[model samples]
Target chain A: MSEKQLHEDQFYITGLKENNTSVIQAIYKKFVPKVIQHIKNNNGSEAEAQDVVQEVLITIYQQATEKKLQLTCPFDAYFFLLCKRKWLNELKKSSQKEVTFLNENVSKDESLQEMVFQTETFSEKQALFDLMFQQLGEKCKEVLRLSFVTKSMEEVAVKLGVTYAYVRKKKSLCTGQLTQLIRESVHYQSLKNK
Target chain B: MQEEMYFAFEQYLGNEMNLEDRAAFEKKLLEDTYWKESFELYQQTHQFLKTKFSGETAAFKQNLKQIALENQSNKNSSKIVPMYSKWFAVAATVVLFCSIWFFMQSNEPKYVEYNQHEKAYFTARSEGVAILKEAQDAFNTKAYESAVGYFEQIPQANRNEEINLYYAIALLEVNKFEQAETLLQAIKSGNSVYKEKAIWYLGLSKLKQKDYSSCKQLLEVLPESADDYNKAQEILEKL
Candidate 1:
């Protein structure tokens, strides 16, 4: 990743991570109009287009925060492709009838495809982790939540009325259990296959 | 045993293991794919939890929702801008060039086009001031040189800003730029109805002097509330 040249538009990712208002507004102004038009062309409404754009941005923010997502292609192409794929998937999910999918000339750039894939994978894994987390026992869920949400293990212990050593040990065990549950899921298996 | 392994994973990640134990852990991971994958997943789970609980993520989502709402509402209000077809684009270009052509035909702002100053009215203000009457008549008749001469003869005590404004215009018309600008500057600084007029004339004085850059600079400062603002814009575009 270091060997590949980072595009100058990487500032979009940085702006997103920083949650800068003007940058987000610029993204909406410059790139979102194209995405909205595409979705409108593909049997989607303006409200649905807004949802797809917001979801794509949230996924990008998550990936950047967790995995340091680097952009090699222009942000416009990458962002539009992500929104398009998301809207298509939404169409596929909601339409029980035969829905005609318009296959415009999506970008053929290898790097753009790879970047979109990475973000999608990250989003799927996040969803899987959230689902698996909810399925954990109440004790484990409480321990994990307090462990992460608090500033430190000591704070977790103080909040839960447990000893510091117990909180520290419970944090590891709960995370481990969560990881095992994720790996055993069909979703994780399918993601790995992709 | 599984619980103890997770504890070890935590210690390894936190760098709490001694050198010998750390080396042994690394060797086992190198030799065992199961242990290696488990360790990787454990680390990833830790990162996911960190990001999930982060305040920054929540704040980012809140900001994104706000911005998206604002953008959507603004878009709806404006309605979609029609995608111009090829012919539409060509038509727009033609209109644009036509306006530009007409604009270019209206050449550089001439002093005469804007120099139709209102007729000086001093007949009532100072009934017995003979020289004020002379100044007003000379200015009204466009005898600006003699207007300047008559204005100079008026006593300083009787010479009010209104009279001074007329004197400055006479100076400007007769090409006495330094004295004209000085008097206009004083009235421009004073609080009077003619303040804005003084500013407009100052711009015109610069224009008549063929000082295009300075003229543009002065005209650009004319506020929209001024009566001459639209005229100033026309000169500005040509300049």
Candidate 2:
């Protein structure tokens, strides 16, 4: 498909928010073979490739929902880079061994690299947010953590033994508090100016 | 003005303001310089607080220090140390609580379930093709029951018409001629790539059910170019 056609396809696929299983399955069908080929070329098995592909797709879904991910690169190259990096990470984590192969054509795309880097940076920021969530008072921490982690106001309310309105209030306050903290922190100030 | 602004700020920040109150507060933020300045200050302070308290390492260090001091004080008491170490105890309790919460949450239908055959079955059709490697595996292993089970789980919501054709073949293999016939009929009416096979199977199902006339009617609809067209023609002759 032309790059424009692929972009349109991805837009169509990502627009499907209600019944995502079939859209996700379609994306999986189109991209998974290339991912599998990339992984197998780098000393990974088909099964491992399948697991990595699924993880990459799930990450894309979560990012799209929670962070409102937008596509500026072709979906094929972007997906390929993500799966490749994920497999490399798996290899590093499992055996402490490095496997190198000729760079795939997808990796040569500068925009694809930038997209992958942006996703990785967002993931790191989220991880830091999770880490900082532990510093609040137990009640505040529990409420805020459940709000983001569960993505459900009613469930967070039940868990925190509060009314739903109270939970919502607490979440907004907690998030505002967190943002204020980040703004004041020396690290955050430096990072922001950077 | 500052106090009034603070009250409105608290309400707005807490999401406690009604719609009118919210609109008034936002209007003030947009138009009133004094309210805007205080709101900005409040925003700055809130951001500061969040940064200071978000890291788990800080929490872990405090917890560890408290545990060490408690252990030291109890050294002379001759009491048994807790078998569940303090950190492990906390971790275990958290896990248990989360498990209960998740179990309760799971009362809603799960979209995915993992089983070996189900995985293979999905993988076979994951490409949107009618390849029967999974079905053939099930058949070869005499996992007919599981074969039928897997076949039945294909989501009707999005499957192309080819799936119905495969499902009918699976049903026929499992000796579900009645169900197979219904599926084959649906496929025949649709613009399925498997329309020819559906026709052949419809005839076979009717033959199995001893409905010669209906079988003959279906067999006549098979295209001459179909692989099974001659077989269908022969079956019609027999009927």
Provide the TM-score of chain B versus the true chain B for each model in turn.
0.55, 0.42
Q: What is the DockQ of each candidate?
A: 0.63, 0.02
**In model 2, where do residues sit more than 4 Å from their true spots?**
A1-6, A12-19, A45-48, A89-95, A102-114, A134-138, A145-169, A180-194, B1-239
User: B117, model 2: CA deviation in Å?
Assistant: 43
lDDT of 2 at B186: 86
Cα lDDT of model 1 overall?
0.89
| Candidate 2 chain B minimal-lDDT segment of 10 residues | B110-119
Report the poorest 10 consecutive residues by lDDT, candidate 2 chain A: A1-10
Pairs that collide in candidate 1 are none
> Model 1's DockQ?
0.63
A162 Cα displacement, candidate 1 (Å):
1.3
State the lDDT of candidate 2 residue by residue for B45-143, as single tens digits.
444334334343244334333433443345424344465478678999999999999988654322122011112333454542443455546644757
